[model samples]
Target: MSAPSRIVPLLAEGVLAVEGTAAPSLSAGAAQPLPAPGRYLVEPLPEAPLTVTLDERSVTIRPGGWSGELGPSRGGRVTGRARDDLDPGRDVTVLALATGGVVARATARAADGGRFTLDLPATVARAPYRTRLTIGIAGSDHVLGRVDAGRPPRAWGPAPEAPRLRIKISTPNLREAPLWGDSHFAASLAAAFERLGRPVGVDCMDAWYGRTAPEDAVLVIRGRQPVQLDPGKINLMWLISHPDRVEDAEYAQYDRVFVASDIYAAHLKDRGLPHVEVLHQATDAVLFGGVAPPETRRSAPVFVGNSRREYRTMVKWCVEQGVPLDLYGGGWDGVLPPGYLRAPSVANRDLPALYAAHGLLLNDHWDSMRDNGFLSNRLFDGSATGTPILTDPVAGLEAVFGDTIATASEPEAFAEIIRSCLDDPTPFLARAARAREIVLGAHTFDHRAATLAAAVDRIAAG
Candidate 1:
């Protein structure tokens, strides 16, 4: 007997099969109606690589060679495919320009899938700097663009004076492991401001305590306990961790407040704090993308984080369950049965490869953050490596990650999920790809830098 005629959906509605071929019927759920019967080539769309043009000169973006150049004006037009594997309807691309102490950025989303344009502020200081340009869906590893101006542009009359937006960021010393996150976060924010043509200074909390900074500067503090800074400047408290630790009375001291999680913002507002904005943790996409995976990744699950009670519980459960887990973080000594941690601690820069070198990564949040939906920076870090991660479920996390991440409510579920993922790596790989696209699309440090620049501009205006 002849096999029943099978049907497959076409790329667009109203596409008709070729004459004599089976007329594939559209499902009731098909979005569009059938069009007049005619020949149609129905297939998946081809890859749409970026086509960057500078001053009417076409530049090819490749992995090893220099591609494009920007004038002192730092304005250009970019045309590329609007859709990617993640979202076929996506039409936007984010652009970031980073130089010595400066970052200029803009977004260009093509409406007609023809071309999009981006123009940076002409007043930005002219200098040679590395460019990290990323277009979502085009793939996250596009960091080869560079701007090589032989020298500064010729002076054209007297240049205009720049904006007065000097910022001084104070955080704990870099040597301290517990506070390294705060230090890295503050440094990244400072670099972003510098890219925006703002003079920024960062110091250990103790160095700036009870001391004055540059006149008319803005001071930003990132720590558990607020430290005294130059009282003369407007201080902004960047609560990176332990939102609940910030007392109600502490809210009045700073000109503005920034939290790392949107849910934390609501919690603080509920606690009567005002002028709070959510500045989610962002990964340095270029750095993470540069990390090369090891030739042999361990078959067992791996996790890279400090030894906390909750994290220890999950690790211990893995050991008891006969699953070999490699741990990387400080203070794990004597915590696990012998042979658990491959190394005492791994550098933050090495985290991406470490993540990529494993089939599965485990994550748990700080108790306060977990309860309040404050996603950890690890979430972004692991995702950037395109590695499957299993984290504890948080309320509203689906909005941020959708089905790209897996969550286990309890230790047993975590173990069970890990086993299932190990048995079939297909689903995990698929989710990792989706999550990476999301991270590159909206959660990179460039995105956070733009958000911070806008927020500072608004606050400075007043």
Candidate 2:
């Protein structure tokens, strides 16, 4: 063999081409923001050599450079047909997933014809959420196919020529806070509507002064920053948080008002704003839809949220009780004891893994929200991750989540619940699975998009 061809074959398939004196100060993998964590296809050799620092520490890799690919699936039912000359009745376990979380698992057994089908649970198979398929063959030392966790492609059709009333989701979050502000909510909602073949855009508060077009309708997301009503436009509002900041003037000219809390919706309607309705916040199904296997997940409690300028109740309880916690958020500098805080903030993309790693999620709502029924979006996001959640009491919590969630008004109950989870997590894991079904099936941005889209279509017709 030639010297170049016999160079030990470090990496398979010529995937990586790195040569340098250890490229310094560069961090790859999940640690940094750039170069997202996923498989990248190398098309051609570059003229200039790439510089990268390979970690000296040992790492695990598949023996044959595993490849995982999700086959075409519809309604969570993944089917396959092949003429295998190997063995009959040798079933391959198929795992259907959304993002990285396993939503459904099925077995595809090879019959005489070598044909097989994987029927993923319809409860978790919605097109709005991305889906991946994993096939685990028996008697394999290495995970053969690992690319199902990667991405797929889809193209959109051309837009209509009519003067359509597109939507503008206006929020107080700035252009800079893509991963950490209200813009995440706005952007997800816009994408949800876009998937339904509607034109939707997101504009931060600073850009909303004189930028609206006559063909645009506004959907204001009310949080800490309250936006004023636009009288000349078809304005709809979703009052999700910061109930105390809501003002009559801010929602006066809004064509429709969707409150997060049924109680708050009534409160607004009683004040002569009869256009108000209840519409709770939802989760990003594809992004926050997966859970790690039980054996692989950690059993410690995790909390991811800011202090909101005050010591959150569940966090204080965890600290006082000496619970081993993975806390990630901001505004926790002087409040938390030394070594208790894990990170100032967890990146938006990293939240699903964070939720999957921990056994339990610690959630809370502000005083106004808890009392007035304005459920925090955290509840929805955590539930979607399939993490058993222990949240502070909120009005109608039972009605919405049923018994899937554990509510603790006092520290003692909180401790009891955590202990129970640590001791026997089977019941909690079941609850988490049920909660994930609820979120993915009904409480996703796709569900909310239908309601919001109908409202805009009505306005356009009028």
Candidate 3:
């Protein structure tokens, strides 16, 4: 027996099909028809046509069509098809841009095989100009393609009158802040040079020495690392407030040298360096502020530092003395005792808030031989936050903060100081407030920048 003649819907109402040789038909008055053998390209009216596939089991309908390529200029184009099987009435769109700005757009109907074209502006080969191109589908919001053009060169001028001062600190990475040290010192120094309208660059001393030239002045902060320098070039070096490194010949090449403390100055003088100056470190108030006296006294005390050495000792003492202590910083591992809070590593922006949350902040010195020249960044952070500090009796600590900071000669003495603060919190709060005022006035980035600028001027004169 011959197979029954089958029929399929020619196209949905209002849908136009692209001309093809093999097309399916459907039986009269049938709710559904058998599978169609050939492909029928169709465009729906008023909207992009949705394409439908018919098979033995089911009928599948999907929205829109493949994207098509636009022509290429300096920019290129993408093109594809669209479908709206159910509606049989839809419009398609093309979007384009040039110079990063929108240049043109085109809308077309899918009825005539859904073909469309978009043109892009030509690329400019000259410098000192800008070029960009982008294309997206209309109505659907899907981006088709993108292109970029040339950018014009920026104008240049003569270098500034102020000297270019490059300061170097010895550390592995520029991103890591010094533990138990003030990162603001380097940042403030850079800011200081900026305020004087001088060109300044700060980086690791080892890195700076790698790029050192006759024109570059080098300021080494507690840097024990070796640096290669050119002898004939005018170079200035400052040891800052740090211990003397064994690498004296490396430091001796600089034209002028400075030390922050008398002890450090004497050590450099003993090494017979030329034009050594003793300049005490100063702080900037503008960068670090918002530390006001607390409204009510609280017994909560906190300490921040790496859990390397003397931290366990300090924590043990605080616990033994029945004090509520909180700690923020890493390296604790299994070292922390019960009742101590471990705060996540604080960011520079959030440091002020962290300090303000506590009543007192403790500063501990490393006990190794390297500790001699080390000064705590916590000193400045505490001062900036107006948190009363109970620090170790380091030589420079008193000079840096004066009588504003309470010093502890020993672990027992440190515990006693905390006890007294807990007993009469008013004096501690007063001391913390005073400390903030002192740092703001003298120990800020602005002040350091000026100092650096003046030093640079003097070096240039000689």
With a 3 Å backbone cut-off (N, CA, C), the pairs that clash in candidate 2 are 68-146, 68-147, 68-148, 101-290, 101-291, 329-344
The parts of candidate 3 lying over 4 Å away from their true place are 1-160, 174-184, 205-215, 240-244, 270-272, 291-298, 309-312, 367-375
lDDT against the true structure, per candidate, is: 0.56, 0.62, 0.55
lDDT of 2 by residue, 248-332 (tens): 6456547788998888888888988767888998998878885454455676899888888988888888888877788898899
User: Regarding lDDT, does 1 or 2 come out ahead?
Assistant: 2
lDDT of 1 by residue, 193-244 (tens): 6676765666664454334554344545455334433333445666666666
The clash tally of candidate 3 reads: 48
- Model 1 residue 312 CA deviation (Å) reads 1.4
Q: On a 0 to 1 TM-score scale, where does candidate 3 land against the true structure?
A: 0.57
Where does candidate 2 stray beyond 4 Å?
1-175, 212-214, 291-294
Q: Look at candidate 1 and give me any clashing residue pairs.
A: 14-35, 101-194, 101-195, 102-194, 102-195, 103-195, 103-196
lDDT of 3: 0.55
lDDT of 3 by residue, 152-202 (tens): 442223325655667666554556554424355676677767766776777
lDDT of 2: 0.62
lDDT of 1: 0.56
Task: Tell me the TM-score of each prediction against the true structure.
Answer: 0.60, 0.62, 0.57
Q: What CA RMSD would you report for each candidate?
A: 23.9, 25.2, 24.2
